[model samples]
Target: MNTIGHTIKAARERRNLTKEELAQKLRVGTHTVEKYESGEQIPSNQTILKLSTVLDIPTSELLKKQNI
Candidate 1:
């Protein structure tokens, strides 16, 4: 998987959030979340920022970077 997908998966698992649950929280479709996890697509910038907030991590972490 890509770094972005790997990071997202790790964070989601740490938070105990299923794809459906995370999608619901993001107000996006489960397919979107699936694509993200599968590394088929990347989330939009706004979505990444929102996910970082919802997941209680910095955007850099979500981006697979050590610093934001």
Candidate 2:
């Protein structure tokens, strides 16, 4: 099963967004974005919402575990 990190990374890549760009939009450090993509950390609900908006994906998509 794909973790949230994997989902986030895929979505971000689909949008052609860099980690730094995503971090800047989220008001976070690039390392934090890295952690999120690495499954070392999980973003809060607010952050998830921001990510959905920034990535142009549905929040439900972000919350769902994908089959990688």
Q: Positional deviation of 38 in candidate 2, in angstroms? A: 0.7
Question: What's the lDDT for all of these models?
Answer: 0.84, 0.91
Which pairs of residues clash in candidate 2, taking residues 3 or more apart in a chain or in different chains? none
Tell me the TM-score of model 1: 0.85
TM-score for all models, in order of appearance: 0.85, 0.91
Worst 10 residues of 2 by lDDT: 59-68
Q: Which stretches of candidate 1 lie over 4 Å from their true place?
A: 65-68
lDDT of 1 by residue, 1-68 (tens): 34777878888999999999999999999999989877778888999998898888888777764222
Per-residue lDDT tens digits of candidate 2, residues 3-53?
889989999999999999999999999999999999888998899999999
